[model samples]
Target: MNNLPIGFYVDNLYCFPVGPSGSQRFCYLPTTPRIEVLGNEVKARILNSDDAAVLALQIVWEADTDTIEKAKSEIKNRYPELSFINLSLADFRGVTATLNINKNDKVIYSIGPINTSGPDMFRAAFQDTLKSAEKEAVLNAFNTGESGVITIVYDGYLKLNEIADAEFDGDLATEIKALAPREVEEKGKGFFSKKHKILTPSPSLQECKDAVGKAIENKSLIIQHKDSANVSKKAKDTVIQEIINDISQCVFTKIEEVGKNSQYISSYCCRIKKTKAESVKFNLKKSYDLVGTISESRGRDIIEK
Candidate 1:
């Protein structure tokens, strides 16, 4: 499992179902999100860089004790909680909020992803481990009250598609792309207008993706040229990234190993190619400080563009 070394700022990590209907389940406000949740999420804690460091250590310590000791030695001094209140109330645009953890996990959980590959869907399941005092405190808060005041910071792997290539992401996508040859069972198919529409194409998943790319490029939404339909670079580029984002999330949802266990796609930090729908592998220098502060608003301003 590859641990992702990047972060995204969520305005409020507490947007669950308001009632037992289980119908309404998504929200993304660019400003202070006014969600109407019942008695929960008030315990949410807005994290600072140091607080993030603590959580990171909790994750790392479970894997390597030496690394945790070294990390603890070098982490920044704890700061006041007043510093990161801005993140708890942000308006991140276009990230799919459909990923979910285990049902047993007391933390936030979303719906399982749609995988056309087979009847079996890959859901995130964590091994049982006793939480340390510090780790317990953080989870107690992360799982508790987060209605609309606290932002979420996840430390995980970037999607193989987000890394742009198999080489950059240790052939993560290459492995998945290879799985294309396997036989799949037709399940999880949905219908509209009383017609069945399989989310994952039966035998042409890659072919369908390629065709989509070509169609999007050829018939762009915003036609730049009056005579040409595929002339708008802006709309094409924007939609292309969105497509990549969807594929990446699909990778995250369907392929449990490709998520935090692989690498993280920074919608807030990294940039996708304006001309191509795919992203490329990052040749990030192996530095502790670079990993020390994984803020999405590092190079970019915290204020929304």
Candidate 2:
């Protein structure tokens, strides 16, 4: 049987990295990052031992009986950091890959060598009655899904490009005032005491207002539905049945449309002020480091000069 396909996801760990100028032989530990707008603290635990720049990932996957062996072998070889168990049965739930950053502006790139196993609900369901053949047949037929998370211990943070802050209350005046790059000023004097200056700022308050207004407009949620009362119906006993003359006239088209639109609003925003975050300025320079495990065969050491 064909092995199940792997889905992808990025367990976001927002950061800002300040690496050593030019080039350095070592990566520093990453610090806990705080959301600048909301003041929410994201504590990132550092997981490095001695001098090896380590990245530990605890991958809990679900695979069926036929594909379990292949999945385990692939994971074990791809990520030397995971210490997986001897069990093959079930399906994957989700997917994705990842890397971490710190506040000081440096990207730490490496993977840990250790895979651990956990109790899966599907595998444990067949406690004592289902025979091995029955269990194998059942496991071979189901599809659960796969997902993973990498807890970064190395000290780093990520500074992404400044997009609109999504968290600000949809107040035009308030966002304009907060987003202003500079402020109005005054100096000593009473009547003529205080010297007032009119600062014509670039991207004036009106421009700021328009920008925020547009951003809000772009992120607005809209749902469309048709009223059922308008549809001519007949009272068949206590139930209302549509008196349709044509069999092709669909009734739930509007409902299905609404459901489709709802899918757009399914997930929350990121890094957009009130949302989670990502960026184009966010660079990915480490090659093979994020996915491969520590190999003694390489025999190359990266230490400070």
Per-prediction tally of clashes: 16, 59
The Cα error of candidate 2 at residue 2, in Å, is 8.0
Score residue 115 of candidate 1 by CA lDDT: 24
Runs in model 1 with CA error above 4 Å?
Answer: 1-122, 135-139, 146-279, 282-305
Clashes of 2: 59
Tens digits of lDDT, candidate 2, 1-305: 01111211112111111221111111111112111111332111122233332222222223234343444444445446545433222222221223332212343222332221222421110012222332222222221111111122221122322221112222122333333334356675666676676543334334543544454457542111121211112211112111110100111222123332322333322221221122322222111221122222211221111
Best by lDDT: 1
C-alpha local distance difference test of each model = 0.26, 0.25
TM-score against native, each model? 0.14, 0.16
Question: What is the Cα-based lDDT of residue 261 in candidate 1?
Answer: 24
